[model samples]
Target: MIPGQGGIVTRFAPSPTGRLHLGHAASAIRAHDFAVTRGGRFLLRIEDIDGTRSRPEHVAAILADLAWLGLRWEGPVFQSQRLDLYAEALAKLDAMGLVYRCYCTRAAIAASLSAPHGPEAVYPGICRNRPRHEDTDAPHCWRLDVAKALARTGPLNWWDETAGTIACEAAAQGDVVLARKDAPSSYHLAVTVDDAAQGVTDVVRGIDLFAATHIHRLLQALLAVPTPRYRHHPLLTGPNGERLAKRHGAPTLAALREAGEDGRALADLLRAGRLPTGFSARNA
Candidate 1:
C-alpha cells in the first residue's frame, strides 16, 4: 500500500548482529516521527536474516536501545520465524517458470570480475538459459526470471521525499538471487515478502540501500504486492568519509550509555551531524 493513500505504517527493521549505533538511532527517530505525525503504526521487525551471525542477545540489545531512545514498536517479528512464508513465495515464482536454480560460486564470480573484459558480474544470465541443468538437481538457490517478472509487474517509478523522483528498469539490475544456496531465502526476497505481509506503507532508510530499491521494486511487481513510499536519508559516514559498516568498528549504544551520554544529545547530534557539545568544524 502507498503512503498518502491511507494512514502510514512505517517500520525499523534492524538486524541484531551488533549493538545499535548512532546511525541506528537516526533512522529510528525519523521513522518514529513520520508515524507519530500521521498517527500511523510504527513497527519494529528484527531483520536477523543471517542466522549465522545473529544472536538472541543482539536482538534483545536492539530492543533495549530503541526503548532507551523512546521509540516503541508494534512488534519484534524475527525474520527467522518467517522462513516458511518466504519458501512459499519462492515456490510460487518457481512454478510459474519465473524462478530458476543457480550454482555459480562466489570464487568463480570473483575470477570472472577480475578478467579484463569479462561479462558484467551481475549474474550474467548464466542460469537463465541453462534452466534445466544438472545444477538444478544439486544444491542451488533461486533467482527470479527478470523477463517474466517485468512482464508481470510493469515499469516502476516512485517519488522520494529526500531523493526526488526515481525510476528504474528491471533489465538494469539483471537477475538477482532470491534465495541462497545454503538458505531458503535471500535478503531481497525476504524483505519484499515481509514488507507486504506487514503492510508497510513508507520505507525510510539510509541512502546506501538506494541502489537496491530497483531490485525490491521488481520483486514487488512479481509478487503483485503494493509498493511503499520511500525516503532515503543521508547516511552516516566515518572519519575517513567512508560509509559506516559493522566491521569498521562502531561505537555502540550500550557503551555510550555507560559513558553517560544523553539520548537526547545523540538525537540532536544525528539531526545536526555534529557533536552534541556544539563544536562545529564548519562554523569554526
Candidate 2:
C-alpha cells in the first residue's frame, strides 16, 4: 500500500525517448493535480523498454522538465531496470496457459490486414492453435491467448474522466503482444508489471492510450493483479489538428524552453486557453 495516501494511487508513465512536449506536460499536470487533490500517491515510471532509442540523457531530460513544471513524482523508476520483474510475470502467464509464443512476423500480419479489413488488425490467431513447442531455437514473440484469457477473465471495465465508463469485451480486443522478439519485453507486459510493482491504483494518461487499457485489463486478470482506474486526457494537437509529436518542429517544448520561455507559461499554453480549474485529466 502507498504510504500517506488514501483512496487510490496514480502514476505518470512516460517514454524517455525525446524531450517532454506540450502533450506530455498537460498529462503530467493533470496526473499531479489528481493525486494531490485526492491525497494519493503520484508516481513516475520511465518507459525505456525500447532500448535501441531510449537514452539516459532523455531520461534526465524528462525528470528535469517535470521538475521545472513543478510536477514532482515519487520516483523515476526506469523500465529497463525492471526487465526481470516483467519476465517473472510473463512466466506466470505462461505457466497458467494464458500466454503463448507467437511466430508470426510483422510483415505477414500486415499482409493479412489487406486480405480482410478487420477491427484494428485483429490477430488471426495463427499461432494460437499451434502446439506449444517446448524448444524453439528460432526468434519468437510472446502473445497472450485472448480467447483463453477472456474465458478466464471477462469483460473489462474502467472509468475515464472524459470518455466516461469505457468498457470493452474480450472478444473485441483480441490477442495482444506481451513481449517482443527483438526486445526483452513488450509495453503491455512491462507496464502491467511496473504498475503493480509501484502500487499504482489509478492511471492518468492520454485518450490515445485508451484502447490499450483493454489489453492491460486482460493482463491484470491473467496475472490476478488488481486493475487500476484510468483517465485518458485529450491529446495536444498541432496547427494541422494532428496529435503533437516529434515530427512537429515548431511549438515544441524543447524549442520553447531553448527560447527562454518559463515552464509555467508553457504549461498555460498546454491547457489550450484558460488554466484548467478543479483538476481534470485532458485527452491527448
Candidate 3:
C-alpha cells in the first residue's frame, strides 16, 4: 500500500560508513527544512545496510552532526534494526518472476569485452541466463530483470523538482542487484522500502543519485509503494570540480566542529546557497 496519504514527510538517510561531511550537511539541511517549512515530519534513517562498512560511532556522529547543524528529525530509524522489513520486501520481489540470481563478480564484469555502457559499468546480463543448479555454492546476488520488471510495471516516470518530468530508463542500468551477498538489500531496494515505511512524501538529495531514482520509481510500482516527490539538488563539489567524497578526504563535520567552525553559520550559508572557500555547488 502507498504511504504519504497523510501530511508531507521528508528524510535524510545516510549510511553510517563514514563521518558526516559538508556534502552530507547540505542534503540533511535541505530535507529537514523542506519538511519543517511545510509543517510536516522530518525523519532520519541510518542506511547501515552494509554490515561490513557501517560503524556504530559513525551513527552517533551523524546525529551529533545534524543536531549541530540545527536540524531536527524524528525516529532515527536504523536499517540494521529493520532487516525483517527488507527481507519481506525482497521475498515479495522474488516471488514475482522478475528477479534472478547473478553470479558475476566485479572483476569479471570489468574484464568482460562487452565494453563500458555508461558512467557506471552497468551489468550486461552476464549471469541472467546462466544455468541454475541446485547444489552449487558459488556466491550469487539477486538482480532485478529490468525488462521483465518494466513489463510488469509498464512505462514509468518520476517528477524531479529540478529537472522536471523524466522517464524511467532503468534498462540503462541493466539488471541491478537488489540483494548483495554481503547485504540483504541494495540502496535502490532499501531506500524504496524505507521511504514507503516512513511515509516520505518528498525526497531531497543530490543529483548524483538522479539515475538511481529511475530504478526506485520502477521498484515502487512493482512493490506497490508510494513514489515520493524528488528534488535532486546540486552536489557540493570541490574547487577541482569533483564531487565531495570520503575517498577525496572531504573534511568531516565533526572535524570542522573540532576546528571551531560555527555550525549554525555554516548551515546558514548553505541555506543561502552559498559555500565556503574551496567549495562550490554544481548541478547535473
Candidate 4:
C-alpha cells in the first residue's frame, strides 16, 4: 500500500531545464502557501526524467531558487532515482495489454495523414495497429492504448478546485507515450506514479497543465491509485501578454537575486495575489 500522509500534501515539481523565473516563483508560492497554511507538508520534486537535457547545474539552481524564494520542504524527490518504480508501473500496464510498442518517429508522425490539427498535434496512431512482425529495427517507445485503457477503466473524472468536476478526455490525447526511447518514463506515466507514491493530496500547478490532468486521471484509475485534488492556478504572463518563458526573455529569479531583490518580499506579493510591474495572470 502507498504510505499515507494524513493531512494535505503538496509538491512543487519543476524540471531541471532552466533557471527559475517569475512564473516559477508564482507557482512555488502558490504550492508553498497552500500546504503551509493548512498545516500540510510542502514537498519538492525534481522532474528530471529527460536525462539527455537535465543538467546538474540546473537542478542546483532550482533548489537555490526555491530556497531563495523562502520555500521549504521535507525532502526533494528526484525522478531519476526512481527508475525501478516507473519500470514496475510500465510492466503492470504492459501486462494489462494497455500499452504497446510504437516505432513512429517525430517526422513520420508529423507527416501522417491522420496527424492532428492545430497547436496540440497528438499521436496519429500509426503504430497502434501495426503487427509485431511488421516492427522494424527502429528504436521504439511504449504508448498507452487509450481506447483499450478506457475500456478497462470505463468512465472516469476528477475534481478540480476552479473548474469543478471534469471528465477525463483521455481519447483527445490519443495514444500517449508511457515510456520514451530516451527516458525510462514519460511525463504522464511518471507523474501519475509519483503523485500516488508521494501521497500528494493537492496538486497545485499552472493552468497550462489543466488539460494534462485528464490523461493523468485516467492513469490514476487504471493504476488504481488515489486521485489527488487539483488546482490549476492562472499562468503568469509578461508585459506583451505572452506567457512567461525563458526564450521570451522572462526575467530569472537568479537575476533578481543578483540585483539584491528581497526574495521573501517577492513571495509575500505572490501570496497576496499580486503581480509585480509588468506581469499578469490569466488562464491558459
- Using lDDT as the measure, the top candidate is 4
Which structure is stronger by lDDT: 1 or 4? 4
Identify the runs in model 4 with alpha carbons over 4 angstroms from their true place. Answer: 1-6, 114-119, 133-137
- Which is the better candidate, 1 or 4, if ranked by TM-score? 4
Candidate 1, residue 32: CA error in Å? 1.2
Give the clash count for each candidate: 0, 8, 0, 0
For 166-284, candidate 2 gives per-residue lDDT tens digits of 67655566678888988889887888888877788778888888888878877877787887778777776665567767776525556666777788765655545443232223334
Considering lDDT, which of the candidate structures 2 and 4 is the better prediction for this target? Answer: 4
Question: For candidate 4, what is the lDDT?
Answer: 0.88
Displacement of the residue 267 alpha carbon in candidate 4, Å: 0.4
Per-candidate alpha-carbon RMSD to the true structure:
4.2, 3.8, 3.1, 2.7
Give the alpha carbon lDDT tens digit for every residue of 179-266 in model 1: 9977678888999999999999999888778778888888887778998999888766566555555676657787777687777667
Q: What are the models' TM-scores? A: 0.87, 0.88, 0.93, 0.95
Give the per-residue lDDT of model 4 (tens digit) for 1-284: 11333498999999998888999999988888788878788888899989888999998888888888888786788999999999999999989978889988888787884645665788888888877677675789999999999999999989999989998998998998899998899999999999999999999999989989999999999899999999999988888889999999999998998899998999889888787898888877
Best of the candidates, TM-score: 4
Ranking, lDDT, top scorer first: 4, 3, 1, 2
Q: What is the C-alpha lDDT of each candidate?
A: 0.77, 0.76, 0.87, 0.88
RMSD of 4: 2.7
In model 4, where is the ten-residue run with the lowest total lDDT? Answer: 1-10
- What's the residue-level lDDT of 86 in candidate 4? 95
The model with the greater TM-score, 2 or 3, is 3
